[model samples]
Target: MCYSSNGQFLTQIPTWLIVVAGWFVVHHLSQKRDQRKEARERVDQLVTAILSIEERAVRFHQSDSYQGDVARSLLFDIQRIIAKLKRHPFGSFVISPTLLKELRRAVTLKNFDASKFTRQEANSAILSNIADAVDDIEDQLEQEYERIYLSTEWFVVPSQQKNCR
Candidate 1:
């Protein structure tokens, strides 16, 4: 214990203890901020991937001629999304395991034939699945904005939101 000139009693806490505690707090906050930044970046990557897949899917589905190239690219984007979902911070809010499985199966089965769908039904089904996945991700991110803790953060996504409907 120590007494100040004003006759006030000083705490026995050590200077090193205060410094260590401050360092811990700063380190913890810095880590948290870095995590949030990473999560935001992952979301951006996911949206880019989803839009790329949608574009390729639409192009192939609309094309009447063989589109092996487009099909391959689309499959690649789907696989990218599948991988992205594994690290996407919003996984807790979105049910992605089933989506991932279905996307993988779709890629496996159609990687060779997606560009030239023989049946209109197949195109519709594939398109529906892709659209649903997009919508679900968008919804989850939108909901993320409403989170009490994340309110102070910000992000930017492609302008696809206006055209999704």
Candidate 2:
């Protein structure tokens, strides 16, 4: 009954079907790409913030003020980065022992110099080395990001939970 002049059933094959299918495919692909990009940006920001914190930590030790001012600043940033890590849950990067040792030393130094311990030339070089370790971590993280993107599907990780464990 819906046949055309040439006996073709035009009503059975609606033209809009093809258009809708194409639209769905494009929309899905765009969303995937956008999500990947956003995830990458978040990772980059976390790395940069951590690196900056390490620099501040070095400067704090190097500064004349022996109070808790510098350590407080560095702690604030470390907390911020920790929060971000909780959200993304990418545990690929490991904290270097040297960096961890430096952080611990900074705490000890603060306690020891609570009243009167002047910054000496010998210790300044050690602080610089700690800052350099932080820089190395950042560079390693950037490379890891590139590898993750190339190897796996971006933000749509198969596991619903992105636990570091």
Candidate 3:
């Protein structure tokens, strides 16, 4: 309780209570911001992985003289991306069985030792399938990203609301 100079009563909230409520809001907002940043980084990584796969796939199909070094380096990067995805929190996006199967087939097509196909027509089919798979996966990732952004809420969680009360 508080009193004015004119002797009127006034309601008072303890300063400590106000500080605690502010703390909870700040802490929760910080946590959410961190999560959003992580999500963006993961999405960027996925985009890079998809683009690299597409570029290598297209080059493999178009090049008559196979560059083994470039192909091998691309394969290395792809494998690293796959491993990273396996460990990433975005398992739902990464673990599409169909997409994995298609990528595996593309890897087979990228096999330098076994894939010295003299004819461009022979490798054309694999290119078509891989291209289609890349497009589908990229589109899927983009859709999921959009969904995440669209569905996000700014309201505090029940736990935070409890702290405020």
Best by lDDT: 3
Q: Model 3 over residues 33-124: C-alpha lDDT tens digits? A: 77667877887888788787777767765667767776677677667766766654455343466775677567555445535544245457
Q: How many residue pairs clash in each candidate?
A: 0, 0, 0
Q: What is the lDDT of residue 8 in candidate 2?
A: 55
- Model 1 per-residue lDDT tens digits across residues 1-165: 446554342343466688999899798677767866777776777777776666666566656665777767766777666665655465443444665666555434553464445533444766676567666666666565335125433332212222222
Q: Candidate 2 — which residues are off by over 4 angstroms?
A: 1-21, 89-125, 152-165
How well does candidate 1 score on lDDT at residue 88?
A: 43
Clashing pairs in 3: none
lDDT of 3: 0.63
Top candidate on TM-score is 3
Locate the minimum summed-lDDT window of 10 residues in model 2. 156-165
Cα-based lDDT for every prediction: 0.58, 0.57, 0.63
Candidate 3 lands at a TM-score of 0.66
User: How big is the positional error of residue 47 in model 1, measured in Å on the Cα after superposition?
Assistant: 1.9
Top-down TM-score ranking: 3, 2, 1
Output the worst ten-in-a-row residue range by lDDT, candidate 1: 156-165
